[model samples]
Target chain A: MQLDATDRQLIDLYQRDLPVCDRPFLDVSRQLGITEEEVIGRLQSLQDHQVVSRVGPVFEHSRAGASLLAAVAAPEQQLDLVAARINRAPGVNHNYAREHTYNLWFVMTAPDETVLEERLGELEQQLRLPMLRLPMVEGYHIDLGFEIDWEALP
Target chain B: MSTCTSPSDNGSTLDEQDRKLVLATQAGLPLVSDPWGALGQQLGMDHEDVLSRFQRMQETGAIRRVAAVPDHYKLGYRFNGMTVWDVRDDAIAEMGQRVGELPFVSHCYRRPRHLPYWNYNLFAMVHGTSRDEVEAKAGQIRKLLGATSAGDTILYSSAILKKTGLRLRKEKATS
Candidate 1:
């Protein structure tokens, strides 16, 4: 999108997760020889441009929460309505529609399993869909980061 | 840069602009020779300015990563299992912290103690090319954490529903 060298460098930092610290911007500034204010300002520009999505916690579930990777199968005619209902659940982090038997897919996080059950049961009754609770059968030990550089590949 | 704290060290006051920056970097850290350069051009700032704030936000714990995301499945690691450990109440946090630091142990977290149903207070994801390989790895973790009793189930991804970095600023939905 016609990025300048400075802007490009900032994005490069973004491309590679920026270091987390008390003065994260300052840390980034030191590497690029820019002031902290400039870092803040440029980030605003990126947001204004809608080039970047979010700047929040890539929360490590291991921190302090109960989470599960789960899904729901909704009847075809009621798919959209069911999806909207499932998304409304407080603990549901992500939701999507797929061609598989399990049409609605999502991730749920809460303080505990009882909470998850309570919420899911309510959702099941409300949406009238059978919930397929597929908790992580195995703890997956690998990073699933998508390579943005693939766009640049020939 | 001087940290602008709003009387609360928890950093709950981190505003919109700050949130946007963290969200963008998390969502799309473009892979290019000059990714920041590209970002700055779009954002209307110089390279140095953008870099510094990333450091500041991270320091505040408003965001987590500014690094690479790897594809675990394609890396020849076949077996991926979520091993739920029923460790003592006090030991869960310490065990989780140490386990999370492991390069091989990718995702770790603590949930409720659901007995007979899901008694795991501490959960760690283990991956390897073969079932035996991952099992062996999981055994190693059990030994290290000194878990009382642990059970693991293999979860194969039937399909990925939606996988994208979060975008707080709300871009137009892509079809």
Candidate 2:
């Protein structure tokens, strides 16, 4: 979907630090020189087209819960089955098939370490495959929102 | 005020009310014009109270930002690569910061390496419109790492098996 100037501007402007007040859209509309309804409508449309996933608070990774990056080298034939099984676990949020021997990679999170560990253990037993558990030691950048090069995007 | 909190003390500062707020908005804020008011109504807190709690959370680093999250794939950033680097342990902190500051690098972190299988400790995600673009960006990072970098590779994601961001289980509230 091609975003017009207003839509692009609204996205770039409000990707971070949206106003914290009643009628936040009103404040944003004023800045965009459009009515509050227009802002809401455009956002709604953008969402419908899957351009904008959602407008929400991004919680700090550590502050919210415990999470780790994990990978498994599922056999090529059973890759889809393994992925479906991994996705069934509530904590397994982001899973991907990467170009490597250890193809299936995912991230899992739980309320705390104990629960996260228990879930991981159960998953390991269930998969019966050697899994690489790579927990983050430190984050150099923690999602301050990426700068979208409008020209590059379709 | 000290803003730095250790990862080991996860969720220690958040009280029951804060957890409620987190649960309420973790998925996404209501799309209504008066979202704070709508949330206030749902949680039985005044709109002003809801706003203040979120403000406090932002100040304390509990909330990174409350904003629109764009889908990279939808936005035409089709190629996404997980660029991994094996940097000298002594230079990792400095090198990771430099690599993360690059415009193309989205998420960068130092993770533990499972020796024999995984030699890379630093991971930086690069996204682009094509494989060549992503490879070029990875090349820039490779140049940046220089001598401190032992080896590196880009793991291009072939498919998204699952993409649910995160969900705080309701059962955890009772725990």
Candidate 3:
């Protein structure tokens, strides 16, 4: 779906620091000079088109829970089967197939370290594969929001 | 650009009530005119209480931001690369700070390396409109790293097997 000027402006504006209030959309509508209904309508449309994932708060990784980036070298023929098994685990938020020997990579988050470790251990035992456990030691950037170069977008 | 800070430094832990709020809104805020009011109704919180809780979380760094998360692929960022660099241990901290400041680099971190198979410790996620664009951006990073960079590789994602935000398990009843 092609985004009009208003749609682009609305998205760019609300990508960060959305007002915290009872009628946050009303506040946004006033800024955009559109009706509150239009603001809601536009957002709903964007979501329907899968352009916007959701209107929400992004939590700090460690603050929310224990998390890790892990990968496995799933055998070529069993890649889909392995990925499906990994995806079945509740804590696995993201699973991607990358172009490498360690083909499947995923991120897992649990309420705490004990649960996280237990889940990882169980998965390793079940798969009978050595998972590369790469946990972040330090984050160099604050995930404020991505600044999209709107003009470049197709 | 903001400098790097350890996640642990943001020291406030979530209380029971705060955790409840987090669980309720992790999926998203209600897409209504009065989203806070709707959330309050669901969580048994008043409008002011919900607002203040979210504000406090934002201040404490528990909440990064309340915003619309765009689908990069839909926004013309088709090429995504997990660019990994094996930088000199002594220079990683400084190098990571500079690398993360680049506009195209979405996420950057220092992660532990597993020998023999994985040796890159510095990971930066780069998104671009094309493979050439991503490679060009990675080239910029290479130039920046200079001699501090031992080696690097870009692990381009072939497919998204599954994607979702962090989800907290429903608390089990305590005896």
Candidate 4:
């Protein structure tokens, strides 16, 4: 979709969360010199368009909780079925088909470890596949949230 | 302060700017005096509109989080692994709640275990600043879950790789 200058401006604001306040949109509207309604209208447009995925508390993984990225190997024909099965499971945030031995891969997050194991066991039997749990061993960072294929401007 | 919200009824599809919003905010808003102000200036929109819209989007379910990405490897315990286990039915959800609370375990969930190399379930990511720290944490998990046997592969992230948020857009059908 072609992005107009104003749309780009709106998006830039979306990228940056509104201030933490009683009326964040109102605060933002005040800053940008636009009505709070306009702010809501544009965001509604962006979301209706599917440009934004989620917006909530940026949980500090290191400070408070934890998470992991892992994958599984599945026959090509069963990829769809397997993916659907995996995706159906609770706590399964995102899944990707990598060009590797592990054809099916996904990320999971939860409030706590006992949960991980019990569920892993159930998943194996339920989906009937070996869910290779390859968590991050060492990393300066573990978030794969960026645009993998974004072509930076020259 | 307000519960996050989304614009579920707007019905407008995502464009490039919207995509950029997902990408930029996926990581988390920067820690600054006027983070939204900066973002509005960059996008050329009124900050209030952006703020209100974000609140609305989060209030709805379309957008999931504005979570902080922590520096786990830096902090003491270092080893990280994708610990997969075999669990019984009717107990999976109960177990997930348990695993999610561990300070060391960053991620936990259930996924499909295909077969052969994949026959494990219940996944969790444990982070330690050190390898031994990671093992100790994993051992703690084993005790908590009561698994007969378990497996974990250490994914030493070779690189930082890609880190961004996803914004799924609907493509109009072509006649």
Candidate 5:
């Protein structure tokens, strides 16, 4: 979707701290010199267009649950089947097909490590594929929120 | 001082109320005037109570941030590359931090290399409007890694097979 100047401004300014108060749209609108209804209308439109995924608190996975980056090399023919099975699991949140030997990759999280491992083990046995579980050893940087410069895009 | 809380250590810290709060807002906050009130109504608690509980969670580092998560693909950043590098273990921490500071690079982390089969230890995700743009950004990372980077590859996601917001199911089956 083509973004107008207001949309661009809304994106540029509201990356974080979205007015944690009653009538957040009113607050935001006042700052942007627009009406509260306009603010809400614009946000609703953005949401409808998939520009803004959500407006809420993003929990740190470490605090929310135990998670790991798991991958498996699926035969091209079976890739779809394997991915569909993995996606069926409740713990698997994000699954992707990437260009690599280990093509099917996904992130799984559970309430605890033992539970996570048990689920992964069950998945491995059911899929009959060696699931490589690579948990983050060290997190250097997270909270990757930033403004996108639309003006600079070619 | 605020320190990183490991998921393993903090998993049990989430009480029933916290879990309820999380599950409630997993989809997103209401776009209405009083979202906390909306959540409070759902939980049969006061709006102030909900807000205070969230504040406590934030202080404890449970909630990362209350913000808007934009869709990169919809925002014109069509190319999302997970650039992985096999860098010298000794030099990874410093180099990883530097690479993470790049504006376009998000979610940088050091993961264990599985050896012979998998050799990448550092991962930095770069987003751009096109494959060429992402490739250029990956090139910048390569230049930054310099001699410390033994080998690297960019795994561009072909398809997002599944993507969903976090949810704490009522059933304990998965957990």
Candidate 6:
């Protein structure tokens, strides 16, 4: 999808620290010197194009609940079936197929550590593969908010 | 006005009201002139209260930031790589922070090294418009790690099977 100047500017500017106010869009419009309607319209359009996933708060999972990244090496023949089963578990939120021996990777979050382990154990038994539970020990660089110089990068 | 002055004030333990607010905005804030006001109406709180509470949440590191999360793929970042490094345990803290500061690296964390099978202790996620671009970014990290990194691997994601923001559920509901 091609991005216009406003689209790029809005994305770069609003990626972090959106104003918290009654008329947040109005404040943004004032900064960009665009109308509030235009600001809202561009965001809506960006979302429609799937460029902007959403405008909201990114919650801290560990604080909100207990979460861990777990992976299993599904046999090539049963990759789809295994992945489907893993996804069915409510605790499993993000699941991905990465190129590696431990191919099926996912993140599971539960109310507490005990439940998290139980769910992971169940997945291991059902999938018939040893699940590698890699819990987060610490975060080194946590701020994902990037100052995307879109024009600079290809 | 309780502003979270320290990073330690992580909004982990939430009251009923806090949970309701988090649940309401999990999808995304509505695009309206008075989003907080609308939210307040839904939660039966004043707009000012909603704004103040949310600000505190951000200050506490419970909320990373209130912003537009751009889908990298839609923004032309087609390739994504999970770059793992087997850095010396003693040097990982310093090295991981350095690798994470690189603009292209999104998430950098120190996870348990499940060995004989998994040896990488430090994981960093890098995104690029092409595979070459991603590899080049990883190369920069390798250069940064220098000899401290025993080895490294870049796992390119082939598919995103499922992705949903983590939602907290109350009670001992076994899955």
- Compare the candidates by lDDT and give the number of the best one: 2
**Between candidates 4 and 6, the TM-score winner:** 6
| Model 5 CAPRI rating | medium
- Better-scoring candidate (lDDT), 3 or 5: 3
Point out the higher-scoring one by DockQ: 2 or 3.
2
Report the C-alpha lDDT of model 4 over A1-154, residue by residue, as the tens digit. 3434544455455443445654556666776778877766655554545454333344234221234555677788887788788777765666766545666667655434566566666777888776666554333212322211112111
Query: Model 5, range B76-139, lDDT digits (tens) per residue?
Result: 7777789999999899989989998888887899999887899999999988888888899999
Pairs with backbone N, CA or C atoms under 3 Å apart (clashes), candidate 6? none
Error of 6 at B150 (Å): 0.8
**How would you encode candidate 3's per-residue C-alpha lDDT over B1-175 as one tens digit per residue?**
3322345667356666677778788777889987877888988888888888888788778888898777888888988999999999999999999999998788899999899888999999988898888899999999999999999999999999998776653542110
> What TM-score, computed on C-alpha atoms, does each candidate reach?
0.56, 0.92, 0.90, 0.48, 0.90, 0.92
DockQ of each: 0.14, 0.73, 0.69, 0.06, 0.64, 0.70
Q: How well does candidate 5 score on lDDT at residue B139? A: 96
lDDT of 2 by residue, A1-154 (tens): 7799999898889886788767889999999999999999988888888898888888886776798899999999999989998999869889999999999999989988898899899998899998899999989976665688888765
Candidate 5 runs further than 4 Å off: A21-23, A152-154, B1-12, B172-175
Residue B84 error for model 2, in Å? 0.6
Ranking by lDDT: 2, 3, 6, 5, 1, 4
Q: Score residue B170 of candidate 6 by CA lDDT.
A: 42
Ranking by DockQ: 2, 6, 3, 5, 1, 4
Q: Give the top-scoring candidate (DockQ).
A: 2
Q: Which docking band does candidate 6 fall into?
A: medium
Over the stretch B44-130, how does candidate 1's per-residue lDDT look in tens digits?
665666656555555654445554233345334445565557777776667777767665676776666544444556667666666
Q: Which residue pairs in model 3 clash with each other?
A: none
lDDT of 2 at A103: 96
What shift in Å separates residue A67 of candidate 6 from its native position after superposition? 0.3
TM-score of 4: 0.48
